[model samples]
Target: MSCYDTNIYKVARLKAGKTQEGAAEALGISVESLKAYESYSRLPPAGVVDRMCVIYDALYLAYQHNRIASGDVKVIPEIEVLDLPRASIRLINRVIQFAEKRRDRELLTIAEDGVISPEERPLYEEIVAELDGLIQAAMELKVAEAKEL
Candidate 1:
């Protein structure tokens, strides 16, 4: 089933306090079209689907902000740090190796001072750290795979 087949459209309409006519008017479509969309009797065009997603996302954001403002909800944004498990190591290293090779080309040049500017330094460091992690993970995976063989 498509993501649109989920309750996102219904929830958005309810939250917007819009009847079929109102929603259709807002969306520049017929009431029958809106009904068909909500009931999934007919799938919308790709542009229509994109528009619907944008509208629903906006409505949801408004609802969230309103709730937070009125103290009806305490919003806590989540920060997730994903560390890839061992199985992904070879793929990761291959990607990093490719990137490092690309960086060695003229496309990744710096200024003649041989010193990276402050703004560029952080990006460089982040890239280096990511490549290092990928290489390390790949090495570990190769050893494990070798033992299995």
Candidate 2:
């Protein structure tokens, strides 16, 4: 038997106020199978893992909504701020516009070049910093959305 921590499953079950048998019925699995998972006697299959994630996400959202309604925590939808460099944003915009017009991968080459003019170096650096922020924000957004679902 593969030893895997079924922490996620246990947490989800607890959060939903479900016993092992109850969760197994909800998930269309045998109670013994659910017990095996909770005890780490066996690892769930890939399909079970995917289903568990979906169920957990839905349960998490419902829990959050309930908590908010009960005034347990202030309901604040998370917002991520991206402070990308103006120059980079402008360059990206220009590239997008060019691509829209010409519809070629060649234009992307110009965008990928690191040969910034001396005067544009500072702007480029700022854009790079902003790009980092943007990427972080996007990742955060994805996490938030996943939790919401």
Candidate 3:
């Protein structure tokens, strides 16, 4: 079974001390969209899911950091900083954007007609290969960064 569910999102949002409106704004989505997601009426797209993970992870880190700074006497959980410096994060984001574009282009090539043209086949394959590589690189970078911390 997939680990993703609306309840997890809701719990994380509440834990982060964010109102629905605030979380929606931070996610660059309308409140209605957020509501739909939380209600399980609509599934988030792949890109949106990636952004969701990033946003929630950031919120978690911020919460831990703030709690520690505020002199909370509670046990401080071990926190990891997955966010790299601005330049690195920007580059990683660009790679993801590029991968998404490549994926769309590959889909269009395959969906152009009932059958992929002989000429389109090679191009489609190339795009798919590159897209896989790009996405894998991005995931590896994220995992490695998290591991380092």
**lDDT per residue as tens, model 1, 1-149:** 43234544565677667777877777788889878766757655655654554554332323222333344333322111123344465556667775776754422665456778886787677666655555545544443443344
- Global CA lDDT computed for model 1: 0.53
Q: In model 1, how large is the Cα lDDT of residue 31?
A: 88
| lDDT score at residue 102, model 3, on the 0-100 scale | 67
| Tens digits of per-residue lDDT for model 3, 1-149 | 22232254565577668899988988899999988877767655555555665676533433333333445553333223344564356547757776667667677758878797887788778776656655545543454465345
lDDT per residue (tens digit) for residues 50-125 in model 2? 5665655433333322333344443333223223343345446655654565534432443567566676567556
What total of clashing residue pairs does each candidate reach?
Answer: 0, 1, 0
Question: Candidates 1 and 3: which is better by TM-score?
Answer: 3
Q: List the residue pairs that clash in candidate 2.
A: 84-130
Query: Higher lDDT: candidate 1 or 3?
Result: 3
Residue 131, candidate 3: C-alpha displacement in angstroms:
30
- For candidate 2, what is the total of clashing residue pairs? 1
Task: Give model 3's TM-score versus the native structure.
Answer: 0.36
- The model with the greatest lDDT is 3
Ranking by TM-score, best first?
A: 2, 3, 1
The list of candidate 2 runs beyond 4 A from truth reads 1-6, 58-140
lDDT of 2 at 111: 56
